[model samples]
Target: MKKIILPLMVVLFTACKEKNEKREVSFPEEKTVETPKDTLTKALEEEPALLSLDDVADTTFVRLRDYNRDFVYDMKYATDDNFLKTKVYDCAECYVRAKTAKALIAANEELMGQGYRIKFFDCYRPHDVQKKMWKIVPNPQYVADPAKGSIHNKGGAVDITLVDTDGNELEMGTGFDFFGKEAHHDYTGHPDEVLKNRKLLKETMEKHGFWSIRTEWWHYNLTSASNGKVANFRWDCE
Candidate 1:
C-alpha cells in the first residue's frame, strides 16, 4: 500500500511541475508611430489655372501667330523647321519655360482683338545647351551656369516681348537677359514707351498666374508649384 501511494504522489508532482513550466507565449508590445506636421509634408501652393488654347478634344496643331502685343520686329531662337510644337515644348532640357505651345496659343487668343502676337527669343533651353551658353560666357553675370541650372529648364518660365499688329517689336530698353544698366527697370534714361511695355508684359503675365523675376524684366515663373522638379532628362532636341 505504501509503495503504491508513493508512486501515485510522484506522478502527481511531475504533472504539476510540467504544467507550471508551460508559459503562454507573448508577442512584443506595439510601438507608437508619429506623423510630420508642417508645410514640409503638405502640397505646394497652386496658382489659378490659365486658360489653355488647345482643348483636350482638339487634335490639330496650330501655328503661333505672335508673342505679346505683336511687334513686327519680334525674333525667335529657331524657325518652324527647327523648333518643337509639343504641349510643354523643351521643358526636359531647360527650366520651365514660357510660351509653351499651349501657353502661346492661349496668350494669342487672349490678345486677338488687340492685334498682338507672341515671339520667342529663347525657349526650352536644355541643360547641356545652357552649359554651352555658360561656356560662351562663364560669367553668371549674364547666363546661369549649366551646373547651377536656370528657371527656363522648368518648362514654366519664359523670356518674352511684345509685337504690334504690323509685326514690330515693342521697344524695350534692352534685349532679353541683357546684363547692363540698360536692362534696369528704374533706368529712367530709357524711353517711357519701353518702361510701359515692360510693365504691360509683367501685368499681363502676372494676371495669368505668372510672376516676373526682379532681375530679368522678361523672365517669369509659373509660381513655385509650376516650376516643379527640373527633370534631368535627355530630349531629342538636345
Candidate 2:
C-alpha cells in the first residue's frame, strides 16, 4: 500500500505541473506597441474646408450656390418661360447679399426639418435686367419699376416656392408670377392644400426676417435688405 500510494502521489504532482505549464504557454505576456497618431491628423488634413457666412460682408453679394446646394433653382429670366417671353439674363444664377443669404440658409434649415426646401425661381435681379423686364411687361403689379428699383435689384428679394424632399412642388394656387387676384394672400378661393402650402411658405419666410407683399405669394424680401442700394454686378456664366 505504501509503494502504490507513493507512485500515485508522484503521478498527480506531475500532472498538475504539466497543466500549469500549458496554461502559461497558452497566454504569453502582452507587449505594449506604440500606435501611429498621424492617422487622425491625416484624416482631418484630407477633409475639405467648410463654408460659412462669417467672413463675408453684409453688403457683399454672394452666390448662393457657394454657401448651400440644397436649394433648387428654375431661373425664369434665364429662359423664355416667364411672362416676358424673352431671356433677359445672360445666365441662370442665384445671388444674394450676405445677410440675405444667411437668413435664407436659416429659413431653409427650418424648412428641411419639416421635409421641405425652398426652390428659387428668381433671386438678385440686376438693375439692368429689371429694366428689361419692365420694358416687356411694364406692369407694376408684376414687375417693379426700374426707376424705383426692386428689392431684387438690391439683392434682397427672392421668387420662391416650397418643394418636398422628392422635389415635387407644393401647390400654391398659382404658378410663379401669376398676375391675378387668385395669387393674392387674401384670396381664399383655392383648395385647402393650396392654402396650406401658401401659408407654410408665408409663415416660414416671415419668421426668417422676410416680408411678403399682398399681391404676390412667391415674392419675399428681407426687411433688412430693403435699404440696400440697387446693383448691376452681373455674375459670370461659367
Candidate 3:
C-alpha cells in the first residue's frame, strides 16, 4: 500500500509540472514600445486645432485663411498688376464677412470635387479702398461708387476665377478687370472652351447664393450682404 501511494503522488507531481510548461509556452508576455518625447511633441505642434466659423456672427469680418486654406489669393489690388495700376490695399490678404467666407468655402469645396479651385483676385474692399479704386476707374460699370458703397465695401463681394489642379487659370473670354464688351457674360463671341469655363464659375457661384454683374465675369456678390453696412476699417498688414 505504501509503494502504491508513493507512485500515485509522483504521477500527480509530473502531470502538474507538464501543465505549467504548456501554459508558459502558449502565452508570452507583451513588450511595450515607447515613443520619444520630442517626436510626440512635434507632431502635436504641427496639427494645432483650426478655429470654427460657426460661432462667429455673419457680419463679423474674418480672414479667409484662418478658416480654410483651400482658396488661392492673387489680391490684385494689393499689387500694381490690377486695373487700378497702383497698390490700394496695405497688404495682400483676403478678408470677407463670416457669411460670405462660409459660402465661398462651400463653393470652393464643390469645385474641388471636380478638380478645380477658386482663386481670388480681390475680396472685401474697405470703403476707403473702394474710393481709391473709383478714383482709378470711376466708371460705375467697372468700379462701384465709394459714396454709395458697393457690396465689396460691405465685405460680401469677391472677384475670383477658377484654376485647375495644375494652377492654370481657366479661359473666360478676357482677363480679370477687362473693361470691354468681351468681358460681359452675355458675350458668346468667345470659343466654346471659354464659354464653358465661364458657365462653370457663374453657375457654381449662383448656387452658393452669389450673383454676378453683366459686365464682369469675375465679380460675384453674396445675396445676403446687399443690406450689410459698408465697412471702412482695414485689416492689419501684420
Candidate 4:
C-alpha cells in the first residue's frame, strides 16, 4: 500500500550520534505553552497594517504530499481525517526567508553543495489551526492550547530544519515533539560534529534576518514577519 505523511511537528535543535557517528549539542526542552485567546486579534488591533502571509502577492507552496519519498517523518502533515486545504501555505514570506537564507549560508558551501534544504513544520498558523497542533500533541507543557493563539499565527515564526537533496532527514538530538531535556541546546557531552552542524544551521539562518527562539533550534522568526500585521484571520493548512 502507498502511504503519505507530513513532517510531524519538528522540534528544537540539539546534538547526538549514531552507532558510528560522532555526537554534538542540542536544544533544551523547557515545558509549558500558554497561548492567549485574543492574542491574534490584539496583535492585529495593535498593528492593523502589518503584512501577514495573507498579504503576499505571489507565492506557491510546494506540495510535499505528492512526493513519494522515505525521508519524511510526517507528523505535522498527517491527519486522522484526510485534511483538506492543508497543503498550501502563504509562500511569499517563506520564499524571502529561503532566499535570504541561501545568501547567508553561501560561505558554507559544504551544506549548500550537499543540497541541504529546509522543510517547515509549521508556518503562518491561525489561532484556530493551532488547535490542530495542540490536539495532535496534547502536551500542554510543549504544545500550546489551540483555544489560545500561537506565534505561528503571526506568520513570522516557522518551525523548520535541514534535509538532504534526497529529502533524507538528518539526525538532530531528539525527534520532533519530544518534550524532554535532551532537546536542549546547551546539553553537551555528545559528539562534536552534531554540535557543529546545529551551529551551522543556526548561524546561517540568523545571518539572513531570521531569529531563532531559545527553545526551538528549528524555529525562526523573520525580522520582517511583523511588518504590517493582520490577526484573527482564518487558518487553513493547505
Query: Which candidate number maximizes lDDT?
Result: 2
The lDDT values for all models are 0.56, 0.91, 0.90, 0.51
lDDT of candidate model 3 versus the reference: 0.90
lDDT of 3 by residue, 33-129 (tens): 8876786457556754667998999989999888887787798988999777899899999999999999999999999999999999999888988
Q: Tens digits of per-residue lDDT for model 1 on 84-111?
A: 2112233322222323545545655665
* Candidate 1 ranges with C-alpha deviation above 4 Å: 1-104, 224-226, 232-238
Worst lDDT run of 10 residues, candidate 4, spans 62-71
**TM-scores across all candidates?**
0.55, 0.79, 0.79, 0.51
- Could you tell me which 10 consecutive residues in candidate 1 have the lowest summed lDDT? 58-67
Q: How would you encode candidate 2's per-residue C-alpha lDDT over 53-119 as one tens digit per residue?
A: 8999999999987777778889998999988888999989999999999999999999999999999
Q: Look at candidate 2 and give me any clashing residue pairs.
A: none
Q: Could you give the C-alpha RMSD of every candidate to the true structure, in order shown?
A: 20.8, 8.1, 7.8, 28.9
Clashes of 4: 37
User: Cα RMSD for candidate 1?
Assistant: 20.8
lDDT agreement of model 1 with the native: 0.56
TM-score of 3: 0.79
Comparison by lDDT, 1 against 2, better one = 2
